[model samples]
Structure formats: structure tokens, C-alpha cells
Target: METSSGKKGVWAKIISFDLGATGSKKVKFYRQLFGFHSTRRRGTQTRRVFTPGILSKIPHLVLGKSVVAVPPEACSQLLDFLSNPQWKPIQVHVVDGLLSAEQVRRAVEEFFSRPVRLTGGEVPLSQAVRAVSRRDAGDPDRRFVERLLDQLGRFEWLKEAVRRAKEELSR
Candidate 1:
């Protein structure tokens, strides 16, 4: 999928996988690994909710898809999986937009790990400027903001605004 700029479209889809019957070992393991909590609703129906800090390690199971969505809290586990050389080139899409695309991309690049293309939208220019303005010089996100500014500088329509944002951030 390509947009007007010829960049491949970033698409996201939500899929449900049944881990077997309720209370089974497969179901229990999936719940524990994904940090899913069960709560009873009206009648006997139960709902599963995802919580953070539950995944300690990547499961031995292999995902057939080339892209997988993981929770933000499992960053460590995700990193471990990416660091492993045995797996194929799979792109990781953080399930919730808890982390920015630039942040994830920077982290993956810094670690020299596998390439991970984040799903969803990029940070807006105004938001990027605001973030850079709010952060201190030592902030890690400063580089991302700088890169965004440089890219925006090439567009004639955004050049002036990008220049102003950079000038403000410098002060």
C-alpha cells in the first residue's frame, strides 16, 4: 500500500486467537504470558484485560505472521526476542501507542537489532516541536526532534515553520 508520497501505507488490524477452552493449560499460559486478567461480567461471561509487566520472556511458540503487536510493558522481552538471530526478519508493532514511533525506531537502531516498523501515525510536527521545547538538552528524544525538523526543512511549505521551531528550541 502506497500513499501519495509513495511511502508504503502502515496498516493495523486487530485479530483474536483462541487459546483453547477456558482454564486450560494453553489458555492459562497465554494469559500469564500476555498479562491478561480475567473479570466476571453480567452472568457467567468473563472478559480478559491486558495488564503491563507480566511478560518475563518470549514464548517458545512461533508466530506465522511477519508482523506482531506487543504490549509496551514487554519492552524488555521484545528486545530479547529481537536480539535473537534465529528468528526471521519480523517487524514489531507495539500494540498500544504508549511509545512514539520515532522512539521505538531509535531504540531498535541504537541496539543494532532487527528492523521494526511501528504501526499507526507519525508524531505531528507541532507535537514534535512541543516535545523538543519541553525537554532538556540531554533528553534522548532531542535527536528524534532534530531529525524531524531536518526532514521538514526540505519541504518548502514547512520550511519557515520548521525554522521558527528550531530557533525557539535553540533558546
Candidate 2:
């Protein structure tokens, strides 16, 4: 991962590389990792101490083989940066909570010209990339469609998109 100064350092590698949100919530994980804190008064409030500078300081995040789990707000900027020709080959795994499945799919497809699949659970980066690449191989099998539906059904936010995908498949 390259910092804003165009230099690779220990902080960049440690945070953007190995520190991935696998089983935990992405927002919470990022906050804790970046030293930001949240509190509840009458309503929930988050301390904006370290977040603004942290993200700005890191322009391009290179996860190598690891999956990149970023906050929803940063998704657009990350996608834009990674859409460059040099970064095209990298496989990205956008954390799927706040953003709808369709939104993520559209963003990725628009940027990378590849379809997105919701694994419904944590999956190896290689496996997820292979699944998407297979879907792009022209004809999709019924079994693949069925499995995709099953995975999409796991997330409530993806229910509408799943229905749309089923309809498209039926056609």
C-alpha cells in the first residue's frame, strides 16, 4: 500500500494489508484500527478525531492477495483509484453491509467491467475472484445461478437484487 507521500511504510502495510475485517463489522474494525472512538449520549455519536486524516493519508491501498474491506463512504474513492490500468488485476472484496448488493455490483461493474457476487459469508479472496470470473465466462449454469441465489438470500439487503437476478436468469 502506498501512502499519500508515495512511500511504502510499516503503517501502510500493517493497516491496509494484514488488518482485514473478516468476522467483525467493517466500520467498527476500521474505527478501532485507526484509533477512532464512538460514544452514545442521547443518540449515538462518533469521534471524528483520526478518521479524516487517516483515509486522506492513504491514497492507494494495495492489499496484494488479501481482501480489502473498506467503509461504504470510501468505496467510491477506492474504486476510482483502483480502476486505473495498473491496478486492474487486483481482486477486491468490498465489505457488504451498509451498501446494497446492487450498489456494490454496479460500482464494481462500472469501474472494472466485471460482475460482483455476494458470497453471503467470508470467502477466500481467490475463491471469490474465481467465482466472478467464471460468471463472466459467457454462459452461466443453472447450478451457479442457484448457488448465487442461495448466497444472496443470506443478506436481507440483497433480497430485492436476488429477486431481480432470479427474474433475469429465468428469462
Candidate 3:
């Protein structure tokens, strides 16, 4: 966990490291609802290969030896990990610091904890709603789906979860 110990009292935190397409976001989400902290983001220069072994190399973000990973891969990989080996017993919540990218390279460039907005600045709920509606129908291409989700701002529920996960990340 990266910390600023030079000043102030010791603040124990759970720092979650999210490496996505756009950038690497390291945030410490306090258990108290709405409390959050972020790390200086590292932007991605290239898209990474999504091989399982390769994907495991991200430095283990362990809380006393417990490790968790929300990999930088396709949604299918997330599905496979969940179904095949039952990777994550439960879904982990995040503040969505990194806005999902349309292209893998773009995802690599995003910063962790930097939420993506649908239009100008704010995240849209419409985009999220549209994405779910389209994806549920098995639409082949959902390019516009993501746009709609951002417009919908459907991720409002994730705020507290992200905060809790942040504590887990930092530990």
C-alpha cells in the first residue's frame, strides 16, 4: 500500500489496485460510506495479452496474504473465471475509478478510481441501462450499449462497495 507517512497520523487503509485499459488506479476506500482515497494513476502504453498465466502477474494486492484480482481482460474472461474455477466466491465492489474503454488499448490508458462519464463530465445512468437491456438480448455488438450505460448512471449502487473493497485493497 502506497502511503504518505510523512505527516498526519497513521491512517490504516485497504488499497485496491485496479489495472485496466486506460490506467492503473490504486484507491483506499474507507469503510465509512463515501470515504475514498486514490493513488497517482499510471497510464497504459499498450494493450496486454489476456492469457491466464500472464494475467496473474500483476503484483498481488494482498491483505495479509489474501489476494484478489479483477483482471484487465474481456468480460468473457471474467465470466470464465467465475464459472470454470469459481475464482471469486463473491463479487467484489469497486468505485469504478477506471471508466471502461471501448477499445482494449483505451482501457489500458485509464486511471484507477477515475470513473467514466457518459457525456461531458458526470457519469450517465442511461448508458448503463441501455447496455444491460442490449446485452440481455444477446446483441452481437454493443458499442452504443456502453454509451447508454454511462448515460444511465446505473452504477450508483457501487459507491459503498468500492469503499469497502478499497479497504481490502490497501490491507
Candidate 4:
């Protein structure tokens, strides 16, 4: 059945890539609130890339009736993208690294003007990894490896690695 907005399902489009502190919260928000469980299919990664190369794709994929929860780091870039005259109008909300249920509900309501009930709970790191991994078979070890690869490619990790490498070389 379609919602009054003509959109099907309750899942929100979240553009979070990492499973770290902030990323974890966004993933949990998508899962618990929107029931957006990542399918166990290869190449089902979230279209969260914010580069100019994929900007058009991201807007096409997510700019619709579903509420989009953007990570704080992507907020500025996403805002800039939305500001482009060529881009269509879209609703967005930037979530902090952590939040309470009340905060989440308020943010959603403010962005979409619809009341939403959010459950508050912690998803274990291992389980979150398994949930977000693209492996067809549910293997804990493989999920962990996939999660590590995902984390390592994040901007924050790259920045830290470069910083540490520079320090070690200087010393």
C-alpha cells in the first residue's frame, strides 16, 4: 500500500557508510525505525558517496518522498549539492553522532512533518557488521572482515592514517 505521499514502505534513505560511532547510530536509526535491513546480496552498499562524480546518481536514488538522514560529515556537501539550481528540492535532516529517542523523533518530525516513533537500543558492533555486510551467507568472520574494509575506507580513518604516518616519518 502506498502512503498518503504515494511512497511505499516506511524505510528512510540513510547515507551513512561507516559503522563507527556516528555511522552506527545512523544505521541503527535506519534499521529500527525504518526497518531497512541491508539484504544479503553482493554490491548492496548504501549510495552514500558524496562526490561530484556520483552526485547526480545519489539525488536520483534518494530524492523522493522518503526522509533522508544524512551523516553530519556529509551535511555541508549535501547542502551544497541541493543548493544547485539544477537540482530539485529535497527534504533532509542531519543526525548527530549520537541521539536519544526523543531527539530522533523530533528531527524526523521536523524534517518530514510526520510523527515517528523511534526505539532506543544499542546494536552490538559485531551484529551491526553482519547486518550491513553484503555476504550472502551469514558468516561472522567474513562480516567482520567486510566491516573492517568498510571502516578503513572512511574519510576519518584515512585522515588518521595519514596523520600517524606523517608523525612516524617525522620522528
Candidate 5:
């Protein structure tokens, strides 16, 4: 896994290639060859693909969405891979590193100007709540919220969010 320059986020692959050269020239050569951009932030250098433009060059067979139910910022690190275009033969996987199925589908569809299907299952309610709330609330707390929401007739908030997401994706 690769962490983006103390950004405290992890990516699937972090590669280091030695061209036998040092300094900024090496960074330039690497960027020219592989299209990975390097940035020096707070005295540390980090390599990343900041924009979707570089995705035009990659041949992605499949795009995968995660079922972790994390917020957008938590999974923003995966944009480099997710924004790539895919072909018919490619198969998509619902793995870790996405905000939500409908959101990603909408993004991919909008960027490629094509209808796309995102496959994923509902995250476990407990897991979903924790990830959504960004906290490690215990069972009693979760149960309390569930019961309170049910009593208040707002228990369907998650489902409603998903439905709204689908509606957004359709546009």
C-alpha cells in the first residue's frame, strides 16, 4: 500500500523505479515515461495522479466500487484508478475504495457520457453507521440510534439516501 505524502491515506500500489539518476531530472523523466506526477509538499515528495486527464492514457478493463460506505473524502484517493475508461470485456469489482455505488456510477457515466452499472451490496448497518458517522460507537449507542430513529420515523434515512443517489445517477 502507498500513503500519499503523510496524507494518511492508502492506495493499492506504490512503485519505485530507479533510472539511475537523481534529483528533479529523475522526477521529470519518470513523469514523462509513466505519467505519474510528483509533488513536494511540506518537504516531502509524493507521487500521485491529481486529475482525471491522465486517465485517458490508461487501459482499465474494469472499475470497482467499494461497499465500505465511507464518505467521499475517505475514498477520494482512488480517483486515479476509478476515473479510467473501461471496455465491454472488463469486469467491475465492488472492493474497498469508493464513496458509494450510485455516486461513482454517476461520475463514470458523466465523464464517459455513457450509461454504466455499478455493482455492490448494502453494507452492514452497523458498519455503515460507523463509517458514515466516522466514529466507533458501541452496540448500545448504535441500538439507541436505531431505536430512536425508528421511533421518530426516520429509520429509513439510509435507504432514502441510496434512493436519492440512484436518482442522481440517472441524470
Candidate 6:
């Protein structure tokens, strides 16, 4: 329950980015409830990047977590930065989405309410839980990739980021 200002807790934010044939849509909510929501249009989409910092909207504990959603390159960068051993212990959580930057943000929030399992090797990443089917625990659990792909597909920011990353890597 943390806010951008670093005064309140129970903060909540929701971003829904729609990046499809039409364009991209983004919405942001803060403070446990719907406080801030905005949509920015662009000719092209870009992959969204969320660098959770101490004063980030998300709680401080959420940082340093080895998130499965984190791209490999970003993860590598994170590792290099925090590898000094002076960094704190973080628990990264990975979830699936619509491939929208806004959706990515939503995935992060939804992850809190839903149950997650350990997936990463070292710092146990989080995976969104799935419910049982009619038989019992028969239903296959929902994977993080699903949500992530879904969100990413529509997220203009996310797409753009991916494009940039690919271009940079190509060089």
C-alpha cells in the first residue's frame, strides 16, 4: 500500500494499453482505488518499461524481485546492477498479459490479489495461479506467458520497447 509520494500505503494503479490495428490506449490508477487514468495516442507503439524503485508506486519490497516478466536483457542489466551484493533481497513475480504496457501494469496489480507459485531458479519468480476444473484440480493453471502475451500484443509501449531492443541487439 504505497503511493507515488511515499506517504500512503495500499496504493493501487491500473493501466490498460490497447495497441492493435487502431492504436494504443493507456490508463493509470493510483492509491488502492481509481485515482489517475490517462490515455496517450501515438503513431506507433513502444514496449513499456517499469523500473520499480524505492519511491516507486509499488511497494519497496516488490523491487529487486527476479520477475519472470522481465526481459532477458533487462534481467541481465538488473543482475549486473544488483550483483554488487550490496543490493537488497527482492522477489520478482512474472505474469501473463495482453502485451499492452497498460496491461503489463495491470498484470502486476492482479498478481497481488491472485496466488503465485515459485518458478525462477534462484530468486523464485511468481506465476499467476489457476483454479481447478470440474473434475478437481483438473483445470490447467493459467501461465504468466498467456497474460503477458495478451497484454503485450495490445500494449503500444511494450511493442515499441521490443522493437527498440531488437534494433539495438541487431547492432
Model 6 misplacement above 4 A:
1-68, 88-157, 160-171
Better of 4 and 6 by lDDT: 4
lDDT of 6 by residue, 106-165 (tens): 544443332223232111112222221112222233234234334443433245433433
Predicted model with the maximum TM-score: 1
RMSD list, candidates in order: 14.4, 17.7, 17.2, 17.9, 19.1, 19.4
Better of 1 and 5 by lDDT: 1
Q: Local error of candidate 5 at 123, Å? A: 31
- Give the alpha carbon lDDT tens digit for every residue of 29-106 in model 3: 111112232334348443222212312212112232222323332223433433432232334333222222222222
lDDT of 5 by residue, 1-171 (tens): 234543333222211222344577555543543344334465565533222222222212133221122223323333433433421122323333423345444433332322111122223333333333432444544444344334323222133434443333234
TM-score of each: 0.28, 0.26, 0.17, 0.24, 0.17, 0.20
Q: Residue 162 deviation, candidate 2, in Å? A: 1.6
Candidate 1 lDDT tens digits, 1-171:
355655542222222233323346544444554444345477886644324223322211123333333333344555564444433233344342233344433432322221111122234345556656867887756766677567546533234556787987887
Could you give candidate 2's per-residue lDDT for residues 1-171 as a string of tens digits? 345766542221112333334444545444432334234345465422222223332222333443443433455655565444443344444544333344444433322222223434333322444444445434444455457556545443344555665555554
Each candidate's lDDT (Cα)?
0.43, 0.40, 0.29, 0.36, 0.33, 0.30
lDDT of 3: 0.29
Cα distance off (Å), candidate 4, residue 82: 2.3
Candidates sorted by lDDT, descending order? 1, 2, 4, 5, 6, 3
Q: Report the Cα lDDT for residue 108, model 5.
A: 31
After superposition, candidate 5 runs with Cα above 4 Å error = 1-14, 33-169
**How many angstroms is residue 21 displaced in model 3 relative to the true structure, after the best TM-score fit?**
28
Best by lDDT: 1
Off by over 4 Å in 4: 1-74, 99-158, 167-171
The Cα RMSD in angstroms, rounded to one decimal, for candidate 2 relative to the true structure is: 17.7
Per-candidate clashes, comma-separated: 0, 0, 35, 0, 0, 39
- Give per-residue lDDT, candidate 5, residue 156: 24
